[model samples]
Target: MNHFASIARVPGDPILSLMEAYRADSHPGKLDLGVGVYKDAQGLTAIPKAVKLAEQRLLDSETTKSYIGGHGDPLFGQLLTELVLGADSQALAEQRVGATQTPGGTGALRLAADFIRHHLPTRGIWLSDPTWPIHESIFAEAGLQVGHYPYVGADNRLNVEAMLAALNQIPQGDVVLLHACCHNPTGFDLSHVDWLQVLEVVKARELLPLIDFAYQGFGEGLEQDAWAPRLFAEALPELLITSSCSKNFGLYRERTGALLVCARDTEKLLDIRSQLAFLARNLWSTPPAHGAAVVATILADPELKMLWSDELSNMRLRVASLRDGLVTALEPHGLAQRFAHISQQRGMFSYTGLSPLQVKRLREEFSIYMVGSGRANVAGIDAERFAQLAQAIAHVCVE
Candidate 1:
């Protein structure tokens, strides 16, 4: 009779909780640098013009509300795979690759986790020591044993040597999750040379690579950012890739993403895709179609594709500029050098080196909000308030 009463209450998401607190604060100069979503200079998350145009076209041409099925929208899958791996990818030419549309990158990841849990039952998963919080929970919920490799060292900088060492020690055949670019929470990314070394280790140890490519065009240009994953796909016989269109296409609420698989040949690729379709059917039944339709429309047309690319480039530039502007603003307080890593780091986030106490002080006294771990969304920074934000940071640094 009391079966439900025995369940315990779960804690709210830390980032979302921070958002609620920020909204409740009455300070005129309150700043929110906690949530991971991209914001404009005016503190708004505006949709791209290309997406608007695509949606309008879709509305005019659409006829029915029929389901798109588990593999959802074949054209979307084809184009998105080309977008992730280059259009001229050898894997595609060889018919060794397949794609399954999912609700979002998160859904894609969950599909991968389930596939690993069911098919590769003996294998465990290895993640970065400080990956996106959801990664930890998702795999565990799927009943897979989860482990972590060192990513950031005591100095709060990328310790690739440590990462590779830990990765080397992991049991052979285990799955290792790697950020393709713009590593989450900590914006630190591996250099091209570093990736080669890691690739060597993975090959020697016989590890399965699962690349998370959530921020493709956010860190670098689309093609430039895809280098590592493309390399891995080319060098390895089997690989899993989860890609997101949230930030690049500004389709956050629409939840459009895909899980791409690369096998040794066409026959094996088909077998893997069949499994993904079955898993996807049990997860979300069918992914929402509007987002994928919009992406396909834009990417299919040359002019609209160019417009979307330009908008994405502008977003990347703005985030990069904000990083530099914040550093420059801190120079008067002699903090530029101390926070110089902020400039070197790419994408929307930076591990700002603020301690938990300092973070608390900023929230209570200055009404400035950021994760307790000091991760800040660089895209959320308002250039007009750079000086004000810098002053607040300086005050916290000295305290």
Candidate 2:
């Protein structure tokens, strides 16, 4: 054996493992409710019409293949900012916002983590108790202490009081990572009133808010979905925003996303941008140009932009419909009261409140795959399979 064989073998990702199991299942009707990526009614992930149009435009244009600058394309960053923060954003107009294109949302988060480690190494990072598992792993890999804040309540709703209590305990200068919208694993999100209270705590406690927004158009409409981040930017003097176009824009493999830094002063903004560029330089050197170019093309074209938004709206509605359908299917089974929270939750996922054993049974017996933690990706279900899923879930839960 080699001398460097001390490393222990680690298990594969729970979500990815479920995907593998789903692929290996011989059952023709096996359903895959694992993974965060979006799937259509046909259970296929395809390029959107807007993306195809953008690709045609890019192919028609004669642009050089040179490497993007340290901060990527300023135009792309500006377009992303306007898209997320709105055109008339006071922060953008006043030059208080700076952004950089990243490989994807993961890249943006890693960059933000690295930035935090450099600037506030002593401060611990707070993530939701039952957040996307990757969040904790990424922060830990960045050599920072990670802590948990209560988010989901026992009733399968947002635990605002417990969240506040956790925030109250956070010392000054710590970083708090918030899912700007569409809380992962558990679709429980903070209401606008709860957001206001959280902002108050952050301001009073002098905590840094790092908002991870991966599914903008997957929740409500584009504008409606962006309310949380826009509000955070306007209320908070300084904030960090990481957004991805993978789900909404259907650019998953293209790895397109951005990291934004909003500060009260221009000098501080410059410092942050410079440090981010430095981090990017050592990391991936520069993000791929194709996805950013494609996004830029779609956003710059009014017709294509409208088409993209419309498609995104359809996807969001489909997921919402599945949520309602699941509840309805469970009603006659006498498990409606237990699963009513599924419909109330928004976005792509819902914490089904199933125990680990039930989740295992769902996979082993029914050939249905979901996260081991009982999180189901609602977007994976079509209208036809709603009854099957609900029946399976009810059977597993009641037994």
Off by over 4 Å in 1: none
- Local lDDT at 122 for model 2: 92
- Tens-place lDDT per residue, model 2, 1-399, is 798789898999878878888888999878888888788888888789999989998889947999988788777898999998999998888888998899999999999999899888798999998899999899999999999999986666678899999999998879999998889979988888998999999999999999999989877778987888899888888999998989899999999899999998788899889999999999899998888888888898899999998888998998998889889988888888888888888899999988789989998899988887889998888679778888888788775
Q: Looking at model 1, which ten-residue stretch has the lowest summed lDDT?
A: 152-161
TM-scores for every candidate against the unseen true structure: 0.99, 0.97
Badly placed stretches (over 4 Å) of model 2 are: none
Report the backbone clash tally of model 2.
Answer: 0
lDDT values for all models: 0.94, 0.88
Best by lDDT: 1
lDDT of 1 at 116: 99
Can you give the lDDT of residue 286 in candidate 2?
91
> Which residue pairs in model 1 clash with each other?
none
